[model samples]
Target: MPPRTEAHAEQQPAAVAVGKATPAAEVEPPGKVQVTVGGAEEAGSEGEDDDDDFDWGAAKHIFVLSNAGKPVFSLSGDEQRLSTLMSLIQGMLSLCADCDNGDEMESISAGSRRFVFLKRGNLVLVGVSSSLVETASGDEGGEGGEGTGKEEDEAAAAAAAPECESFMRLQLEYLYASILFLLTSKVQGIFLKSPGYDLRGLLGGADTSLRGIIELAEPSRGRGRMLAGGVETVWMDPAIRSRVARNLQAAQTASAPSGALYAVWLCGEKLVALAQPRAPSHHLSSRDLLLLVNYVATQPALRNAESWTPVCFPRFQKTGYLYAYIGFLEDPPSSTLPRPPPQGNADQNSPPAQHSDATAGTGSIADENEGRRGGSASADGGTQSNGSGSRSIERDSGTEAGGAAGDSCVILVSVESSSEQFQAFRRTRSALESRFRSALGTHWDRYLGSGAELEREGILTKFCTQMKALHFHYCLRGKQGGAPCVTQCLSSPFVDHELASNPAAQHRVWGYYTRAALRVRRGSCQEGRVFCRRRFEGNNGYFGGGGGDGRGSGSPAEEGNGASEEELATALFESDPVHSLAYEVGDEHTVVSLFGKRDGGAGGGGRWVSSSSAGTGRLGGGDELHVCFPSSVSPEDAYKAAVRLTAIVRRDRDWLFLTGTGAAK
Candidate 1:
């Protein structure tokens, strides 16, 4: 498969025609492909192909329409052609509008097709599905035979109706949320107010976002089995989440209006921290958050810098606008080691290019201190110390007057209208960011303990000491086809210290890490098969190759045509959320993120683990990090902390790719 692309435009809203569509097995005329509805398969003629199997029962089609019976959006089929069907649906819904039922419209079943409707003011969300399976009546025998009582069967059918209705309603809600994300409440209001407003034109760019929501809600998809409407959080210790929340809240307080709506910090695409007023009415819907995150993730321009955009939290107010100041934080790249001067003319007064501890094959963890004023690292007692000097904090200086973007957090602050209010908000945000930076610096100092040299002992000691602020960390590094190198904090539940101390046990653990990395890169999850479905199966090819590229059959290592350096780097460092995963594993919460290239494509991905660079072992090729914390932890903190580590990994590639006992040799 070819590597995935960056973004996809929203599909024009439309629905497939209701009918017995052609089956995959039957040979069709040129320019035609089989399209099925429900589970009824087309009887194929002799010599027809039948190898392709699709469960039509799992398919769902969604449509959005105005109360005027005009089509707004559709997830499948042709929109223009589905007007008649939509008119029929609208006509049916009109009859029920004057009934005793309140604003809501419950689902109605028409033969095999179930139509679920949700009325949101002037807009209507409709979900049509032929995949609803018949619920066995309570009176039915375990062997699929009828029970002796007719009343029991009737009661069972009644019992099953609610479940079916609930599922349909949920699907409708998903569609509505997706639309809100694309058009926002304010835009929707505008579209409604204007007579000639083309909702499709307003939703033109959101095709990918809409499709993602549909896939997430579809029962047949892997993510649907795992996540519902809630946001995907980076699992971290509660204490860390609290600290992050405090930071975000503090940031919000710096520039927030008296009625600020939401202040959130996103790491990659998952929400790691959020801050809001204590008012009871300040409830932020998880679905809204999810939708917003997905929207931002699809927007590549928002990744690198701070931007302010007019936004409407549809759940909060569907007809108004709020300005959101969005910015990102990233750990600055490590200062480059000065090149050695020519042997004869080297200046005797110049400071040595190398330190005593720095040697070939030995990776040095550089402190973030060198370039900034009053940033220093000490090696005594294994604790880092900041320089005793005053540092001026500055706000992000983007094209916009007041916003700033950096590597620490994805700051999203809401503000009221008016340039004066925006300027005030920017000042407030800058001051808050300064405070956050200072606090983060202090935290980094405590974690580093003296200097980067402390990491020389090994990956285990490095993780053990650096991650003392929270629970232990589990770090893994591996090549696409080779074994992985893994070391966890001594206190981790997954670690058996006695066995860990054993050389054989250590080798085994290393093997486990290697195998796990391979499995993840290959998208091999069976139970919570989220990545495999979204990436490998769907073949979005954002990082990996496209599925239609006709090369997905080979392993990632075998394909050797992964994303380019810039592409892989962007996937790792950019704000794309779909590339990351946050889900629960048993009682523990595990967040997984893939970095580097593993598309099995030949050249660009070769820079990852085990790939030779200047005849040295590669450190970060095909590397993926998984952090597991107690279920009590939230996913947000987990990601915030993980990204910091990733920043270090990005800088200290030499150390990570070490082949021998000591640094690169």
Candidate 2:
């Protein structure tokens, strides 16, 4: 990866120094490896007699060696001795195999021991294990069970050995991917060119992380990250999920000039939201995004501050690296603080190409760095303290958020190069934090809220208002196999005044519609979570306040009663599942439903459930507005509705969950 441009240097909040690595030649002899670095045994090394460490019940040792046959890592034992072993292994492989043309020497067996080799561009991984795999049948025979026939035993052995080898190969791939994630493909080359470079220094405090990954890779445990090859996404209420995703999408647009190719928010290692532009013919794959997340979580420099690093996402482009800017945004206070005016001098010197409309009147990235630097230099930095109590530039510039610092969240922005739009990234990060805090408010903690609370409350109505713009009516049911569901109907408030004025008279019409939605759910909600009914033929006479089926009729209850069974039965559509997109909209109970519509009407008709019923009303006909949405409404409008509804519903639920211990009101 190329070095940061001068503009980038000016905008960096703090620079981490990279010292020249000392030559490796002075410390060791060829074919002789010492495990100690700086005259002390490395912390994670296993001693020679560490036989008890074989609780894996197999040879769990692995070693890394330089091309010169110097030891870099070992599963156990002293370094000096391990270097000799590495050299011996290399010699044996070279003598027996023809690798001069660069084809790697893979696996070899000597009696009961087998050695496996996996080579990257300049590094090599070697695994030492027993050649024979003990299968279930083998164990049975050894345990004094009736001995199996010789043919069966041999077949089992053959099957088990290959599986073991495959498993070993997977471990090696994980090991290599993790290292690449840490040092990056760019820095790996730097290590090789220096020859004397000690990879341990580059590893820093990452040994524990790597060890944990290895332990997690054991077959007794879950699948390794390589096996999944994608991000482990967190499950969130669909309403919240849509809000978070849409916010990121908007931020990406605002930060475009900063060279942002994509933006993602991760709650630790689990992906919460990912945003990228729609125009680009290319986008990051889930697998590549997961790798990026792994690197951010494992690398101290990236996690600790607003740092930029050059990274090569092998899946995106193999020839070069991209610049990634990573930082953690601490949650805002309980009360929203009035934002300070945008500072002028902070970014007056930014490059012309990096300027953006989203940041037209705001401080530049340089200003952010200045604030951070000044705050840190002073003993009592006052407002400059980062929300987490660390000194921050935003505080210094009066752009710090309100309230005491809260939980910190990560924000990652990647641009193709430093020269792209450095200023835009800073602006986008600031805007995203502000928007997220505003939308989620005090309940913004990703881990907050339980599944049961969301279910009983029927909160999907609070955030599923966007479906109205799409002319979608949805029912979000409870978890019980056969229990009542809180169904929400929505249409734009901008409707025919006649329909809006007299909801009761339209009750029979709405009831018939409700039956359609219910029948769809009744038939299939048990088998699958979502169902959608579509009518492509123009109108089909279902819109004139009449029952489509011409049987049941429902009227608004006389005052205080729940929905009539007849009204409850009229679901949106009743057909074989056509198109369905379901999203978990709450921590537990609610899933936002996405239903499609095809209406050839004057105003693009829609409907919405009003907030009159807190989702528990008997005959819960809380003012349903069925209207024709303005034709100009687009997907962006739906996104905006989702954002607004998420904020309102989340705040409402926070209070509802806290107060409701009694029977439904």
lDDT of each: 0.40, 0.38
Show where candidate 2 strays beyond 4 Å.
1-59, 74-81, 99-104, 108-114, 128-163, 182-197, 203-224, 277-281, 300-304, 331-408, 416-424, 441-443, 446-665
Q: List RMSD in Å for every model shown.
A: 21.0, 25.0
**In candidate 2, what are the lDDT values of residues 1-665, reduced to their tens digit?**
12212110121111110011112222232222222211222213333433333232454667776655666666665434555466665554443333233323444332233455666655677776542344574333352246667666644443333213334544565566556556666645765687545676676676655554554343222232332233344433334445555666656655665546767776555455666544322445333564566566655444444555666554355346677666666544433444333222222343433433322333222333343221112111112112232222232223346423332344545644543354445555666666665555444532322222222222232122323431222222111112111121212121234534553323322222332233322332221111112221123322122233321111111111111111111112211122222222111112232332212221122222222232211111211211122335443443334334433332332122111110011
Candidate 1 displacement at residue 304 in angstroms: 4.5
Compose the digit string of candidate 1's lDDT tens values, residues 1-665: 12211111111112112123232123242222222222222222211111122122433667777777787777775555566556656765664454342222344343334455667767778776552234462224242354437655543333222113334445556566567555565554664677345578777767767776666543222232112233433322233334445655655665534434677666444445566554423444444566667667666666554466666655455455667666555332221223222221212222323422213222334322222323322211111212121112233345232233432345454646655445554554554444444443433322222222122223334442343222232232232113211111111223334543554323223222222333433433221111112332333443444344322322232222221222221122111122223333222233333333432342122234332231112224433444434445465655555555444443443323321111000
Tell me the lDDT of candidate 2: 0.38
Q: What is the lDDT of candidate 1?
A: 0.40
